[model samples]
Target: MIDTDRTAAITAVLDSLADAWARGDGDAYGAHFTEDATYITFVGTRYQGRDDIAGSHNTLFAKFLKDTKLAHEVLDVRFLGADAAVVTTRGDTYKGEHPKKLTKVQTYTFVRQDGHWLVAAFHNTQRKPLMEAISFRFAPETKPKAWPAQLLDSVS
Candidate 1:
């Protein structure tokens, strides 16, 4: 049986992250992660520890990411055990209108710590739609089961 309470708690963490990003609060954003968390950006920059994440984001929030808000849709959430979960989401950062479709895929690993859920690791990847469509067209088996067939067909 699924533990709905735990699931809700895990998702609440994600909500908090989005809220922090919306406010450009790097400290608040990093607080959702573990002290020794590892974060890898889509551009391949890797940050070690919560402090690194927070400090780097503070720089970003002040410059390149200024006024940006993050938007995301949860794709999947699977419990590894009672205390751990892996979540997949589609997300993007935008300054104005929310994106019609998020262009990046992100994976988050959450671990329960001292009765609170926190992200232990995170990886973000930018999706290349053309490359994905080409791959899927040649290898239909590579398509995700949850993806609608009509979408691929239209792309092909």
Candidate 2:
């Protein structure tokens, strides 16, 4: 497949993340990563194991974005080396008549350990979002060539 096609496929994996989280399937959500995956949240929280990630999600699944019928918007996708890539996506967690907006810029490093792209590291943040409405940004001609310097280490 072409790079664009491959990119779309990779993005589909990310889309599933919201699905898993929305359904409150802790095991399914965590299964999307590599065994040694490292995750960093927008609040700078670090989770080393999938257990920690699941535990953390479970704590807020019923309260925040999980109940909000989450949606994602892709901003940019830059490939690093051969098996690494950084993705910037804007998302929203819509709750009861309110959507906790998140301009999530995530760096998803996927490694094809076997034949699937398993997430190695996922670092993301929650940017100030709009109201409960879905904000789909397409043909966005205003992204930076290089990501901001704040993406040095996993903030969490």
Candidate 3:
């Protein structure tokens, strides 16, 4: 089980990483990851190793991401063991004169190495609400919709 103190430390690392991205500091952003970490962008492009992550982010920050600010909400953190954890978060990027174009769910896997927590694998994917895509609607006064058993049974 992960102690409260250890959880806090891991949270701090994630917060710092977001802060660095908001500041357009790629070097600082990548510092929270391990040397052999794997990072996947929202578009599914993958960057391997700390150097690649930092380098790719540096180029992005210098261009389209120059004026962007990162906003993140940590949804959950679960410990895999004493030295490993998985964190789930929702994040948005804001830039001047532009609407919030990207809303992503990020999963970060962290491992304790040499007494410090570092991201081992990071994956970001766009958030799409399935309810909206379908014609289903729910209101406070309306009864809850029942799922079709066939659909659930098929998946099972």
- Using TM-score as the measure, the top candidate is 1
Runs of candidate 2 with Cα error greater than 4 angstroms are 62-66, 96-102, 128-156
RMSD list, candidates in order: 2.2, 8.5, 7.4
TM-score of 1: 0.91
Quality of model 1 by C-alpha lDDT: 0.89
Indicate whether candidate 1 or candidate 2 has the larger lDDT: 1
Per-residue lDDT tens digits for candidate 1, residues 1-156, read: 777899889889998999999999999999999999999999999999999999999899999999999998887788998899999888999989999878888999999999999999999999788988888889978887775343344355
Q: Rank the candidates by TM-score, best first.
A: 1, 3, 2
Query: Among all windows of ten consecutive residues in candidate 2, which has the lowest summed lDDT?
Result: 131-140
Best by lDDT: 1
Q: Write down the TM-score of every candidate.
A: 0.91, 0.69, 0.78
lDDT of candidate 2 over 1-156, digit per residue (tens): 237865876788887887897787767788878888899887898998777777777776755545555677676676765666666666656655534444455667776666676688888776532321122233233333364533222221
lDDT of 3 at 15: 80
**Pairs of colliding residues, candidate 3:** none
Number of backbone-clashing residue pairs for each candidate, in the order shown: 0, 2, 0
